[model samples]
Target: MKPANKFRADTIRRLIVFLFLFSAAIVGFGCSQPILESNECIEARDPVKRFYSFHFGNEMLASKENIEKRKKYLSKRLNAELNDRSDTKFDYFTQTADYPKAFRAGKCDSTAGDRVKFEVLLFWRTNEKNSQRAIQVEMVKENSRWLIDRVESKE
Candidate 1:
């Protein structure tokens, strides 16, 4: 065989091998990504997530506007008047915690399969110190969507 032809064939084989390994690596990484469960756990955790995101003291736990927007995710028992508003703001220089610091779901207690409970962790920092809270969220199914009915800080 000619030397030039031999060199071209060797180069082609190396290119093929590299392409195969690259494709395999991509597939391997994609498969290893975490899969989120589509269950009461996620349903119960989502609202508490939003509440935690807005917990800068300047934000109200339940404002008239937020309550309306989150109404679908709240149980009627907790859908009462919105009177927890305050002008006080704990504007932090920086928020060090990542979202969904942690969460866990418990089995439903209602016979109708309408109620569920879960807990979520949140972190905040003021100039004085850092604080962590585990909030218990009670959720109920309304119109086929999970909604938060009650929330209390386990602090």
Candidate 2:
């Protein structure tokens, strides 16, 4: 019945509601997008979806099988570099965030069906929310397929 306790309870309730809403939005996003599973895209488009996996949080793309299409145009270092950065660890994250209006942006590259460039705004929280908007990736078309050429963003 203290004022501070009431405020804390209200805050916690709001946070819980926000988390539920956020989770529903993410699930809706996954179901709504036309983008196929990462591997299917890679096999059909070959190199295009590998980097797509990188920027958008797909794990299966770091394999040699997915990257083989790049060997002709890109150096061996490309695969090695991506492989090195690939995280096989299963980390857990909580959605202590509000859904961002500009969290991600991209267009399907007109030249290639599977290539997409994403300008993503990533949020990180320590105690307070911090947001940064940056060009996360530019997936390009080569040899009639798509591949992520770079992933970079400025906060």
Candidate 3:
């Protein structure tokens, strides 16, 4: 081919390769990060969701052992409170002896600087019964990490 045609062909090939790599990078990043949720919302919700996942998966109970294992997710005050309570029958986090089968962290509401709350939906399923409950989970950002500060039933 002529010199000009060869040069144009090489430029087009380079452009195509760059576009392909750029598209792949965008897609990879999109898959890794939350598309709709803000960073603050995600930071607040993650600990609560992780805690509940552990809570519900372990026989729907938060025993002392489980609490110890998941203490990093809890605030210092909340952790102490759970440890101080003498009663083993009641769970302070769920505020009930009967636990739900599954849970979801809903939209986050910023309460104050370094603090937010999530409306967590708890779901129960049985052969004859299907029920749900909403709970308010307050989280505080401590040392650049979100921790569950308190939980209250909205019933």
Output the number of the lDDT-best candidate. 3
TM-score of 3: 0.71
* Stretches > 4 Å off in candidate 1: 2-15, 18-31, 36-38, 51-73, 80-116
Query: Per-residue lDDT tens digits of candidate 1, residues 45-125?
Result: 565456445443333333365446555545666666332443222211112223323333433333236666565555556
Which of 2 and 3 is the better model by lDDT?
A: 3
For candidate 2, what is the lDDT?
A: 0.46
Cα RMSD (angstroms) for every candidate in the order listed: 8.1, 18.1, 5.0
Across residues 1-155, which tens digit of lDDT does each residue of candidate 2 receive? 99999999999999999999999999999788575445423443334334333424532233454345444434343445655654423211111123222233333333345445444344444456666544444455556554455555443
Cα lDDT tens digits for candidate 3, 42-61: 67776788888877766535
Query: What is candidate 3's CA lDDT for residue 5?
Result: 100
Question: Estimated TM-score per prediction?
Answer: 0.50, 0.32, 0.71
Q: Give per-residue lDDT, candidate 2, residue 13.
A: 100
Candidate 1 lDDT: 0.54
